[model samples]
Target chain A: MEPWTTAPAGPSSAPEMPSPGGNPVGRVEEVLAQFFMDGKLRAAATDPAYLTLWEALEQAVAGGKRSRPQLVLAAYQHLARPAERAAENAVLLAASFELLHSAFVVHDDVIDRDTVRRGVPNVSGRYRQRALRDGADADTAAHAGDSAGLLAGDLALSGAYRLLRRVRTAPERRERLHDILDEAIFASIGGELLDVELSRSPVMPTPERMCRTARCKTSVYSFEAPLEAGAVLAGADSSVVAALTSSGRHAGIAYQVVDDVLGVFGHHSRTGKADWGDLREGKRTVLLAYAATRPEWQHIAHLIGSPHLTAAEAEHIRRVLTDCGARDHAISVAEDNARRALDFLEHDGVPSPLRAELTALLQGVMDRVRPE
Target chain B: MEPWTTAPAGPSSAPEMPSPGGNPVGRVEEVLAQFFMDGKLRAAATDPAYLTLWEALEQAVAGGKRSRPQLVLAAYQHLARPAERAAENAVLLAASFELLHSAFVVHDDVIDRDTVRRGVPNVSGRYRQRALRDGADADTAAHAGDSAGLLAGDLALSGAYRLLRRVRTAPERRERLHDILDEAIFASIGGELLDVELSRSPVMPTPERMCRTARCKTSVYSFEAPLEAGAVLAGADSSVVAALTSSGRHAGIAYQVVDDVLGVFGHHSRTGKADWGDLREGKRTVLLAYAATRPEWQHIAHLIGSPHLTAAEAEHIRRVLTDCGARDHAISVAEDNARRALDFLEHDGVPSPLRAELTALLQGVMDRVRPE
Candidate 1:
C-alpha cells in the first residue's frame, strides 16, 4: 500500500485537483516524499543509530497530507517567477517543515507519556518494549524507555538542522528562514512548558490563554513559518508577509482548538486512535471555556480532577461539558477564528487562483470541526 | 559570592599554565562566568523559567577547566594574524565549545539518572526534591523529575544552536564547523547508548573499542572540532588540520579514561564530588578493566550491578582493580596516548607556538592519571 493510504482517516475528502489542471495535491505529496527520502539519507548519516530514528521520522511525516507544503508552493507560484528552482525550494521548505513537525511530535510524546501514536507504538514506547523483549528487568526497561525516547527527539532536532543546511537559496534568504524557524521552535518549547505546567496546577485554563498557547506552540510553525519562508524566498513585500502571518495565526489556533475538540469526541475510525484519549488523560482544552464561566462547573471540575475517575466517569464528564455548552462555545470560537483568517486574506493581493485555494482550505477546515 | 568563586573545587590545584606569560586558566573561568551571566539575561528575555535551566547549564560548564577551548585559542594564536577580529572569533568559539559540553553533560546526567553532579544535586534530582517539597504526591514528583530533566537537557541543546548561529565566519567555514558539532553530538549519543546497553550485559569493554567510543564521543568535539574551526578561520593547511585531529583523538580518549580512574580513587577536595559515585552507580569504566580480569572479581560481578554497594565494598573493588594490574594498564594506556598525541605534533612545520601549547595541555591532562 502507498504510505498515505495508512493515514488515520484513510484519505481526506478535499478535491485532489485544482479547477484548471490535474491533481496538484497528489503531485505535491509525491514531490515531498522524494525530498524527504533524500533528507532522510542525510539524517541517517548523522550516526548509524539515526538510521532507526529516520525510519520513525518518515512514518510521522508520511501520515500527514501535503496540505501545508501545497499551500506554500501554490502561494509561491502565485507570487514568484515560478520555475524549476522555485519548485525545488518549495520541496526543501516542505521537507524542513516535516522535520520540524517530527521534532515536536517526538518531544510531545515524551511529555504526554504516550505509548502509542498514529496507531503505532511511539518511539519511546517502542524502545521500552524492545528492552522488555531483551529480558531487561523492569527498572532497566523504564530507564531505557526515557533515554531512547529522548535521544530519538534529539536526533529529530538534529535532522531539522540538517534539512536547513540543504536549502540552496541565497544565503540571506536562507538565514532569514533559519531565524524564523529557530524563533518559532524556541517559542513553541516555551509555550509547551507553560502548557504542561498550567495543566498540572488548580487554575482553570482560560480560553484566551489556551489560544495564546496554541498560537505560539502550533500556529506559528504549523501555518505561519512555512508561508512566511516561502514568501520571503519569493521576495514578497512586507504587507503580504504581515497579512499571511495574521491569517495563519488565527487559522492555526482555530485548527488546534478544533483538533482538541476532535481529541475528545471524534471517531476512532477517523482518528486511528482511542476516542476521548484527551478526556481519559484529563487534558485541558478550549472547550473548557464555558465551564470556566459557569458556576455549575464547580462540582464537575472537582470530579474531573478526581484521582480515581474511571473511563465511565470521564464519559460522564464529557457529557457534562456538552451539557454546559462548552463544546459548542469552543466550536463557535474556532469558526470565528477561521472566518477572521479568511477575512484577513481578502485584503492581500494574492493571485486570484491561489487566494481562492486559500479561502477553500480555511472553510474546509472550519466545516470539519463538528459535534458529529 | 560570584558563582565562579564557589566553583565546586576551588581552582582544581592550579594545573600548570600552558603559556609562560599568558593569562592564567582563571581567565578562562572568568570568561565562562561572563558568558553565563549574559546567557542568563538573554534566556530571561525569552522566559524567566529559562533562567533555571541556564543556571543548571552554567553549573555544569563551570566545573570543568578550560582545556579544550584553550587548546583551540592557543592553536588560533599560533596561526592567525594577530587581529581583534580573530580574537573575538576565538572567544566565540570557546563559548561554543562550552555550550556543546553543557549539552552533552545535561543529556548525560539524564541518561545516567544521576542524583548528584559535581557535588550538587543534579537538575533532575533537584526537580524531584522540589516537587516533593511542594507537596506533590510520590508518583507526581517522580514524573516531574524525569520530565523537567528531559526539558532542561533540551534547553541546553537549543542554546547550543543559538550560540552557533553567532559564528560570523565564511559560509563554508561555518558549514564545516556546524558539521563537526553535529557529527560529534550524534556520535556521542550513540556511544552513550552503547555504554548503557553494555553495562547491563556485563561484557569486556575492550580497550580499543572503549577508546574508539571515547575518540568519537569526547575527542572529536572536545578538541578536534574547536581546533579545526579555529584553523579554518585562520585559513590553515590540511597538514595542520590532520595533525590536530589525530592528536586530539589520542588526548580525548586518554582524558576520559583518566577521568574514569579519578572517579574511582580521586580526592574529594580536588574532584569536588563524591569519590566513589561512579562505583555506587555501577558505571562500567576502564578502571573495571583490572577488576573484570581478576578471579576474585568474578565472584562479585553480580554485586557490581547493585545500586546499594557501600563505600567499603567500592574500596574492595578498587583494591581488586589495583591487584589485577588493570589500573596499571589503564595508566599505561593514558601515558601512551599522551605520548602519541605529542608525537603527532612533532611535524616539520607546525606553527611552533601552537605545538608547545598542545604539548603542555596534553601533559597537564596526563599528569592527573595515577599509576596502580
Candidate 2:
C-alpha cells in the first residue's frame, strides 16, 4: 500500500516515503482510514465507478511521509507534553492536513500532466489507463482521466474540511481551526496559481519570486497551519503559537528550497524521484532563476524545457548550473531558511524535546543537499 | 451579467439566464462582491496573475441566474414569513451556494474543455489568451488555460466552505448547515463524475441512469440542500424541512429534465444556449438514453456524438428523437417530476403563499420545454 504499486512519484510528490519520526503517525492513519471509509461509502453508495476514486485516494494518502500531521502532534506536545498522544479530536485535526495534502497532490498531478505518483498510477493515470483499455482514443481517454481526477480531488479536498467537523473543541478554538484551514488552503492555491503562471510566462521569473511561490505553496499548510491548529487544540498561549508558526513558516520555505534543489540535483535513488525533471520542465525554481541571471545560462537556455533532451544534453546543463554557482546559491538559501526555522528553539514556550525534534528536522532538510 | 456575454454556456452551464421571478437576489450579489473582493486582495496580495483568476471568478458568479441562492431565500421565507428578510447569516449561506456553483462552473469548464463563460473569457480562457498573446502555441495556450481554471475552481470551492464560517448559528443547527453543505457538494461531485463516466462509457447508458445522474447533479445543491438549509436556519420543524426538501428534489429533477430537453429542442433565443451541442457531444441525456432504445435511434446514432454534425443532420436526430416517442417520454418525465414538486404544496407545514410560489416554480421548469 505504500506506493510504487505502479510508477513512482515525479518531482512534486514530496516525502515519497513516510517517516516514522517519533510522531503519533499511527493514530493519524486510523483517523484517515475512518475518514476515507465514510467517503468511499458515500461516493460509491450510488455508483461503483466512484468507489474506484476513493480507492485511489486511500493509496494516495497512504504513500506520504505524514510529516505535516507530525508537525501537528509536535506542536501539540510542546504544550501538552508527556501525553503520549493528542486527543482523538486533535488527531482528526492532524489527519485533515494529510487529507488536504492528498487533495493537492492529486490536483497537482493534473496540473503538471504527470500520470504517476508514489511509483504508482495516480488518480488521473488510473482513470486514463482504464479509459484507454475501454477503447477510447488517446485524447478522449486523457480528457476522461483528467475529468475524473478533478472530481476526485474535489472529493478529497471537501472531505478534508468535513473531517474538521468531527473534531470537538471550544468554540473559539474551532474558529481558529477554520481560520487555519482557510489560510492554508487559500495560500496553497495562490502558490499553485503562481507556479502555473510563472512556468508558462514568456519573461523569466525572478529567483525571489520563485522562492515566494515555493514558500506560499508549501509553508502555510505543510507547516504553519497544521502546527497552529495543533497548538490551538492544546490551548497553547497565543504568543507561543505565533512564534511556533513563524518557525514553521521558515521551515516550510527551507523545505521547499531543498525540494526544488532535490528535483534537479539529488540522487534519484536517494530522493526517490527522477533528477533534472525540474530543469526539463522549465520549472520556476530558485536554481534556474539564479542561473538565468548568470552568464553561463546562455549556453544551455535552449537545451532546457525540451521534451526530448538526451542524457548528454542534461549532463551538460547540470554542469553549467554547477559551474555558474546557481546550485550553490540555492543550497545556501535553503540553509538560511533552515537556520531561521531553528530560531524559535530558545523561546520561553518551546519545550526542550520539541527543540531537539526541530533541530533534527531542519538538519534533515539541509542533509538532502549536503550529503556528498 | 447573465452567461453568454461571450460564447454563452454550452449544455452543462445551466441557468444561463438569471430569472428575476421574484426572489431576493440583490443581497446575494452584494455578498458575492464582498467575498470576492477579499479573495482578490489575498490572491493578488503577492502576484498580479493571481488577481486575474479572482477577476474571472467575479464574472463567473455574476453570470449565473443565482437560482440556487434564490432557492435558499425562498425556502427561508416560507418558514419565516411576515418578515422582510430571514437574517444576515442566512443570506451568507445563500450566497455560498452561488460561490460554490461558480467554482463548479470554472472546474466544469476545464473538464469539458470549455474556455468561455458568461459570454466573456473565463478564467482559463483569459489565461490561455494571455499565453497565446505571449507567443505560446495552441497546445500550450490550452494547457495554460486549463491549469489556471483548475486553480480558480479550487479557490472558489474552498471559499464556498469558508463562507460557512461567517454565518453565526446555534451549534446543533450549525451542524445541520454543515451537513447540508457536505451533502450538496458530495452529491454534486458524484453526479459530475458519473456524467463524465457515462459520456465516455462504451455501453450506452439507460434512461434510468441518465435520470439519476441529472437528479443527483442538480437536486441536492440547487434545490434540496438550499431548501433544507433555509428551513434549518429558520428552525422549522424537522418533518416540515424534510417535506420541503423532498419538493426541492423533485423540482431539481424536473429542472434538469427541462434543461436537457431545452438543450436540444428549445429555441436558442428562449434557452440562451445552443440547441444541438448535447447531441454533438454525445451527452448521456435521458432523451438520448430513451431514444437509443427505439428503432429511429439507428437513423442518427452515428451522428449523435459526431463533432462535425451538420444542422441538417442535427435536425434529423431531433426528428428521430421525437418521431420515436422518446421526446414525448422525456417530456412526460419532466412533467411528472414537476408535478411531484407541486405535491409539496399540500404538505402540512407549507404556508399558502409558499405553496403558490412552489407551484409557479415547478411550472416555470416545465415551461422551458413547453414554450414551443
DockQ of each: 0.35, 0.78
Instruction: Please identify model 2 stretches exceeding 4 Å from their true place.
Output: A1-20, A81-86, B1-23, B81-86
**Tens-digit per-residue lDDT, B36-139, candidate 2:** 88988987887887788788778777777667787787778778745534478778998888888888888888988887654577888988898899999998
Give the C-alpha miss distance for residue A208 in model 1, angstroms.
2.2
Off by over 4 Å in 1: A1-9, A12-68, A305-308, B1-9, B16-67, B83-85, B289-297
lDDT of each: 0.67, 0.79
Question: Model 2 — interface RMS deviation?
Answer: 1.0
Question: Quality of candidate 1's docking, in CAPRI categories?
Answer: acceptable
By lDDT, the best candidate is 2
Please give, for residues A1-372, the per-residue lDDT of candidate 2 as tens digits. 011111134444333322315667789888888888888888778778777777877877787767778888877866764553447877888888888888898898899888877667888998899989989899988888788788888988998899987888779988889889988888888889888888777567898898888777888888888878888888888888887898888888887877777777766775566666777788778888999999998998887788887778888988998999998999999888888888865678877777777777677567767855
